[model samples]
Target: MHPEVAQLIERSHRLGADPTITNYAGGNASCKGAEPDPVTGSDVELLWVKGSGGDLGTLTEAGLAVLRLDRMRALVDVYPGVEREDEMVAAFDFCLHGKGGAAPSIDTAMHGLVDAPHVDHLHPDAGIAFAAAADGEALTKECFGDRVAWVPWRRPGFQLGLDIARIHAEHPEAIGVVLGGHGITAWGATSQECEEHALEIIRACQAYIERNGRPDPFGPVVAGYEPMPPEERRARAAALAPLIRGLASTDRPQVGHYTDSDAVLDFVAREHHPRLAALGTSCPDHFLRTKVRPLVLDLPATAPLAEVEERLRALHAAYRDDYRAYYERYADDATPAMRGADPAIVLVPGVGMFSFGKDKQTARVAGEFYVNAINVMRGAEAISTYRPIEEREKFRIEYWALEEAKLARMPKPKPLATRVAFVTGAGSGIGRAIAERLAAEGACVVVADLNTEAAAEVAKGIGGTDVAVPVSVDVTDEEQVQAALDEAALAFGGVDLVVNNAGLSISRPLLETTTADWDVQHRVMARGSFLVSRAAAAAMIAQGLGGDIIYISSKNGVFAGPNNVAYGAAKADQAHQVRLLAAELGEHGIRVNGINPDGVVRGSGIFASGWGAQRAAVYGVPEEKLGEYYAQRTLLKKEVLPEHVAAAVVALTAGDLAQTTGLHIPVDSGVAAAFLR
Candidate 1:
């Protein structure tokens, strides 16, 4: 058998067991390694082909059947029928009968059309984005433009075989062929060449979508939601100019608008309200990349652009809330096949479509996906039917146990599974107990405090890390915090449990707070929180590892942190940052959250260290009384311990909370959940 075919079968068998490449076991390949394996003496010029029921990524030599190259070429002109195709397949399989129970790949006939020794084929999810389009052929040629050749979708049989032969005869130099609604066929003199061709075809299709047909940034315009007024938009645009330009990643930011008149709006929005969002994309690949819909709105002539912009913000917020609710609903009420990430939709009100991305490339990629989705929606609408995967089936595929297992097994610094955690400031102390408990649960504990020596002693006693490593890091210094996190990453390859345990608590009347104190609080509370989270996020994103970030935020952030101006405001900012990071990086698979533990202690590093104790003394409570006082204030009537908070943190980062992200899980007990308005 050809060595190339041998490798292809070997590769297929390996991946076949993986659920991610589930369902479709079909693929093809050719390689320069197409040499006969010397058995005894006679020359064996047989082709190694992937057999049916084989996964391309996990195959072995035994998984392929050998067919004489000359024989296959001879059959091309024979105008073989289904009977012949079956016989060919059975005969091919028979050749490798002693090798294993493996069968022959379905496209064995087409394999003869290629002269290259190396070849490969697979029905990649991304490749099909363009292949299954209503204008699949036209779009394929337009995007690839002569870089590759294409064949119309034909029923796979004798006629299809003849068509492929004709196309090959015409475009002899073409190294690859893509059949609409089918799969691609790539070949090369060497295995590398064939693989590269496959990669390039995918890249070209993805690149074309990223370039030619992207969606808008703002979102699909909504009813009563018009474009920002010229002056208002200009002003807001300027506000964003600095940040947007920094992240634009282009010579120029292609900022633009899409405001549909009543006619266009009515045309799309007439019968199908929500379904109209899908009309913007042209294919199914878009669904895989950008979800299946966008948002739509109606804009009023008199509404101020600023007001409309504000409403848009509300819309985004509402969408997120609905997303969470939908996930919870599907998960709790009944089985809705496990939905993957709640897909972002194109909002198409008065504003045509608002495309979003961290950079121009991402935005453009997302836009192309959106356009294809629109096409799918439009085509299906023509038939008065447009359906994505059946809900349960979609859920099953999205949340396939195999896929879920694969996602769980994603490469990471370390396998962070089934571990417990301990956080410091246990009890009325929010961050502490989190640290202490996570440690008790098997992790090397991390004790953080302004009392450097005290924390060191705690570390020695807690003994979580080979005995918790004692290190003093002020939350404010980016360098110090980042270095500490780096140390942790290096020490353990990665950190599975984290409790943003260090914080400050100052209850000064907002108006009377001094500027120095305010700035210090901001540096310690808000900026410090940002630095640590940023460092952790970078690490997690790099390895595609998802972990838990339990920000020891106070209930004050959610319930209007009063009296304490600097502390409350800083903590509030921390909470918001958690949400933003969650939304932006969810695709990368990282999750963020805030833990409102109410109160821990006055002498905690945040408030007691430096100004923390002084601030606490002014409130007339000795540092010792701080913990109990806060605990008594809770509705649970039970004290909130650092261990309790730590346990919660551990559960979240562990397998128990696999799909949970962007949550504000309140560990303040039942009391905090019903905090007084």
Candidate 2:
């Protein structure tokens, strides 16, 4: 790789890693270097820029688009002006340097046309504050004088790139320019110089805003909008997340993210919040993720729960109606159809923010982008009135043909995408395998287990909070079960797939099974399944998106076995619960099923906890050979593994068996006694 190109990647990483410098996948960086032409065997200048849909912090060689600078610049002569600038994006492909490393982004022209060795385009809150201000040009001049210039608002495309090139040529002494109602762009003769110039402009703007900014820029907090106490605030957020997620997913299902950060709380509670949010986000990247704006609830956090839910429902309906109208008003013959009328973000006074998307990362990033908008609003209001670009311009960008094309290029979603699964006892054994499998199929999993450390480890291994969250829950305690479900709601909107796998085995004859042993076994297996299923059912019903409930019962539930009286009865209870709930929940589209596996001793938490020794003693076989004994009894002569059970779960939920419910799948490797009659 060229030294300059390597430096460009390093520079992009440094700038992208800081949230204050640029948002996720929001900025682009480029470097111009001479490389040998493959055909001519002569040196040719090439422009290497961050590719479309790539995040800078995690960028690699595959994420940079390589283009021949000469061909890129030659497009200027054929440019059909601003009205036809979008065609330029397609033209960029023709300028590729031996098949571009990555697809060139819309900003490719902006970087290629600029007359500098290195260029950085970023969306820093401080710079956007000036960009979003009503008198942005004057503020830019006030902040950095002639060192950083200002360019008027223009939609990003070939024309805007030309506009910036003109500004750069007109002001040779300027280090960068703040693009009106957008972001900032900087250039330098060297990579280090370019990075330094970008940071200098950003820090300078931040300092100016801080030094000259007024206190309470968002205005004093309103009486009803003051933040709730920490514990109460979190409780409220958890309570509302599912309902909000349901509403947001009206057009299409969305995973949710919750935040009660000081910035969001402060903004939502302030007097000027409604008006500024109504003005919508200023930057294209900001609004693209956040929607045009958020839907803010107009009530206090202390309002009765029922009343709050009622108001939210009404507000959501109005938001959808308004969004549809907005789309209709701006749409022309060539415009892409309105994607969805539902809001991506929702704000409640005193509670903070909830952002939704098709997945957790997207949802989290949407919330982060809204926080950036809040910062921009605060800074702009502190210096001057906040004035974002007009709604028409925002609509143009939001529904751009290029953006639609990009969306079309995205890989098809996984079968379990947008599904949230609550897997109890996911710390180890069959439950852990089930959790991991669900996540791999694209479901967000709540790894609930009594062993908090084990659950945390499993969650971390499955990609941390983005894909799974660990929750400590004693299934026997109804309160803990409820709290675990609440955590699921807060973490990923709500539960739509539930695996009731928490269990224990106490193998003994009826006479030897004391009352204490009987009660303990039933409490953990029968009552535990009941508690988890009941709570999860409520959430799924409320979400109005039908769900799946799988009970990991055992073959002993049906097959008669020696010294298994207590364990068998408890498993029997779970198997019945599956049938009863399946009959009841079908109207609501909730599928309830069961998996029965025999002598899963190898990774079985139940067997490891003394049950295996007792069972082995009863069968007169070595503990290690117990699995072989069980396998010998099976027609398939196979030992049932945890992964086999996990696969059964995937089979039930992954679309093919959508219409099949109230069924018991025996994963006992074809044990005759375990077969369903």
Which residues of candidate 2, in runs, are more than 4 Å off? Answer: none
Error of 1 at 497 (Å): 15
* Residue-by-residue lDDT tens digits, candidate 1, 97-121: 2353444544666665556666666
**Model 2 residue 619 lDDT score:** 94
TM-score of every model? 0.37, 0.98
User: What does candidate 2's lDDT look like per residue over 1-677, in tens digits?
Assistant: 89998999999989999987899999999999999999999999999999999998989989999999999999999999888899999999999998789999999999999999999999999999999999999999988899999899999999989988988999999999999999999999999999999999999999998899998999998998899999889888888888889899999999999999999999989999989988999999999999998999989878998999999999999998999999999999999999999988899999989999999999999999999999999999999999999999999999999999999999999989999999999999999999999999999999999999999999999996989999999999999999999999989988899999999888888889899999999999999999999999999888888899999999989998998888999999999999999999999999999999888887888789998899999999999999999899899999988999999999999999999899999999888877788
Backbone clash numbers for all candidates listed: 118, 0
Q: Candidate 2 has what TM-score? A: 0.98
Query: Which residue pairs in model 2 clash with each other?
Result: none
